[model samples]
Target chain A: MNKIIFLLTAVIVAAIIFFVPPIKGLGELAKIIFFHVPTAWVAVVAFFSSAFFAAKFLRTKNFSFDELSARAAKLGFVFVLLSTVSGAIFSKLTWGAYWNWDPRQTTIFVLILIYGAYLTLRAAVTDEKVRAKVSAVYSLLSVLTVPFLVFVLPRMYFSLHPSPINSSGVEMDSEVVIVLIAAVIDATLIFVRLMRR
Target chain B: MKLFGSRCDCVLAIVRKDFLLNLRRRATFAAMMMFALTATASLSLSTGGALLDEKFLAAILWVVIFFAAGAGLAGTFDDEAQAGTLPTLKLYGDAQAILFGKMSVAFLSLVALSTFILPIFLILFDVGVEKIFLLLATVLLGLIGLAAAGTLTAALTTSAAVKGGLFPILLFPVTLPIFLPAIRLTEISFTPAQVDSSLLVVILAFDAILILASSILYDYL
Candidate 1:
């Protein structure tokens, strides 16, 4: 059942990505945005979910919550990596540099570092009880830190980077919005299907 | 209110005890200062005795302090774990006190290292401090942020099998809001022109939020 759902989602998403005309400003680079933007959203949502489970584990002292937290963070880290690499490729096409230290890029780099630290941290501990508690603490701290790094600090500076999705009021064509919405749903559903294990 | 007062006393007592303990051992203290000096010396030599700008000097200064703090702060909790005093401290049910105590000591050691590093940097790099007061304020706030974040993380990793190797990797990312703006504030301190107060505001805000978060989260560790 899951495989069939995944296959249908994949085929339709791929078709929309290829057939859709490029946006006015982005040209061919627009194709990457379909993947990049949705991947970043999944990563952010996954991290928040991880933190939620971490908080739940801390409160209940239940092993299952810890498992959920660890799994979600791992998946989130993978999505973050995908988003960053895709974003870099898109940046190279448009900004003439693969890494410009744009405000968004800086935030993404911090996100990568935070989760890279998280994975290494998980490996560094062996005691099951200590591992659960410490990683839970770290997961919460890292997630709390995301807002300052990704949103607050970036906006403090005058940035040439794309204005935040909602704030700049960049009008999207109806078709483009539909594809983005579909991509988000597709990415999230994939996350849920795998995380169930 | 009375409970809060006694907790503050406990925190101060821990701070005092830690200071005395560090004074007695002196190993951590000496290592931190020496490491900072050696790192600064290498930078001076690599620059080939040429003059450096305030920007370059600011970057090098924080690098020295960051590494020195990294070297020193791990010992804060690890020493307790080694002596088996950590469980006793836990028995007392005053984790906040312990955290504040560690934070105070971290801040002190970092400041001690900074005092030594600054004079060496000034002489070696030949960059004047355009506003000594501003430099002092900026470094102080940066140290508070570093000490808070470092103490919490070091405590979390205290029970890990590889605390030494894990400490820096875990602590560095969480402390970026400290170092990034700190480097900016330090750069502003070196410039003789009109200073950008915005960076200071940013650092202050980050430091405030970071310290508050660290305190709230310290109990979990």
Candidate 2:
């Protein structure tokens, strides 16, 4: 039953992604948003869940919760990596550069660093209990700052990246929005399934 | 024995002990100053004494301070950990107090290091700041953010085998929010009307959140 649901969502998402008409003004490039935004969304969700489980571990001192947190973080890192790559490609196609130090670009770079450090810290520790405790604290710390990095810091500067929904009164096409939402829901469902496994 | 009664006293005592230890050793601060001096010299020589953009100069100054702090701040808890005194402190001292004390000492060391280096930096780079007050506030806030972030990171890295190396890796990424706004503020200090005053609040918020979270998580460390 679970495998069926996963497969069903996966196929449906693929269909929505490819079949959706090209967004106005962006053409084929608009498809990048489907892949990029949803991956980034999943990454954010994964990191939050990682922190949630880390807090649970801290409170309960349960090793399983630490394991879960670690799993979630690992997933988050992969998703963030995917998001970054897709965003870069999107930038290269639309903005004419693979890596412009745009505010959004810089923040994503920092997010990569934060989680990269988390993984390295995990690898450096030998004692099980110590590793769990330290990494849990580190994840919590990362989550504490992630908001400031992702949301607040970007706003501190002018950005050239296109945001899906923003305060500037720009509206995404309804068709594109549907595909993007479907993509996000699909990525999140996969994440949930992967976590359970 | 009595020093641990009140939180303020506990924090002060730890800061005092750390300061005394720092004075006797005198290595961390000296190393940091030496680093800043060498980096500034390299910058001047590399530029061939040419006048540079004030904003670029501002960025370079913060980079120097960031690296200098990285060079020194990792040892905030190193001495106690090496001497096997950490367990005692952990057992008897309030964890939050230890965190505050460690962060305070780190902030002070950074301030002293900056004071020694800032004049040299200004002289070597031939840059003028029209907003000394703004620069001062930015530097002070940057130092607090560094100390708060570094203290917690230092505590975490104490048990690692390769401590110094892992310190910067853990420290730099987590402190990005602090660094981004700090460098921008420093740039604005160089040219007052270039940016808004809102980033000042961001730095303050970063310090507050990190300190609060560190205080809560210190017990685990």
Candidate 3:
């Protein structure tokens, strides 16, 4: 199972880098999405995973569920950091400034602040159960605003960031689409595999 | 249906109880109101009578409100936490009622502070209220988001050993989106121009989702 997962991720990733056409305007910079989008999508999915287990933990008062939530949030934070940096690179290419206060940029900053606080809250508590309880609550509550922070709030402004995925997602060529779909599924399987462990 | 009505009663009861307690002590209100005034006054002094542009004016007004919220809103659950009534209070209808009750008090208290501070802000800063009704609507909607997010954050942080400093740190970022539209609206309010109100819709929707989510998550805390 593990070998198949690794092989699948490897094949899809290689295809993304070598096969997809360099985007117009974005040029090679768009290649980062193969890296950037999956990390972010996983990060978001991981946070939701965290929140799901958090709700479960709260309902059952089970420590294991809390443990899963904490790991997922922590993993999400790493991808969040990577995506923000990659986004800054993209911004530098397109927006002139690496850190323009664009709506999407601001939303990324907000996400950092949020999970940063979540991690800090987790670390601050000495009691395991208390740590789990508080972190779980934060995770669940934070997810509620994630949609607003990422979607609604950004749209209220005229954003410089390319909103390739609006109510309608990007109209990509089939090859790029196939690669992306595979990458997302494979990345999530890593989490599925980890959870099983 | 009956059970839901009973839950509403419980929420109202908690709201009333908090209001009465807050009225008697007025500690948080005084603290926050004073903070708002001095923050406003201090900003005036710092600028040294230089004329602020419309953006700075809108921004600073909310800086006052945000810091003022920081001053007292963290205590939303502090009274119960400190009094050791938290465990006992959880025996009520649910965390939803308790959260609403706590949220209402915090919302009203901040609104009251805004009521007092807005006039003082106008006089001290020498800015006029261009769109009073629109401004009030913006402020009211902004407060709902601020208060709900604030109350939920307060509950999250009140458990920590290092809560005092962490409150604003957590609260600020979470409420960033809420702050954005209000500043934009305040800017529009200055000119009373016919700009889009899609921002207000975003903030209101966020507030509704936040309160509902907080109520759902409040159970764990």
Question: Per-residue lDDT for A1-197 in model 1, tens only?
Answer: 58866885787577666767787687866578889988888888888898899899989999999999889889989999999999999888888888978878887777788778888888888988888888988888776567567656776556566653676575776677777787888888888877898
User: What TM-score against the true fold does each predicted structure earn?
Assistant: 0.93, 0.93, 0.85
lDDT over C-alpha atoms for residue A157 of model 1: 56
**Model 1 misplacement above 4 A:** A1-8, A156-158, A164-168, B51-53
Docking class of 2: medium
The CA root-mean-square deviation of candidate 3, after full C-alpha superposition on the true structure, stands at: 3.4
- Model 3 per-residue lDDT tens digits across residues B78-175: 88888999777778757778888889888988889899999888888788778888789988998898899899888888778888678887787767
The DockQ of each candidate is 0.65, 0.65, 0.50
lDDT of 3 by residue, A114-140 (tens): 779888888878888778888888777
Per-prediction fnat values? 0.65, 0.54, 0.62
User: What lDDT does each candidate get?
Assistant: 0.82, 0.85, 0.82
Shift in Å, residue A3, candidate 2 = 3.1
Alpha carbon lDDT at A163, candidate 1: 53
- Expressed as tens digits, the lDDT of each residue in B54-148 for candidate 2 is 76888899889998998899888888888998779967667888889889999999999899999899888887787898888999998998899
Comparing 2 with 3 on TM-score, the higher-scoring candidate is: 2
Give residue A157's error in model 3 in angstroms. 1.6
Q: Candidate 2 vs candidate 3: which has greater lDDT?
A: 2
**TM-score, structure 3 vs. true:** 0.85
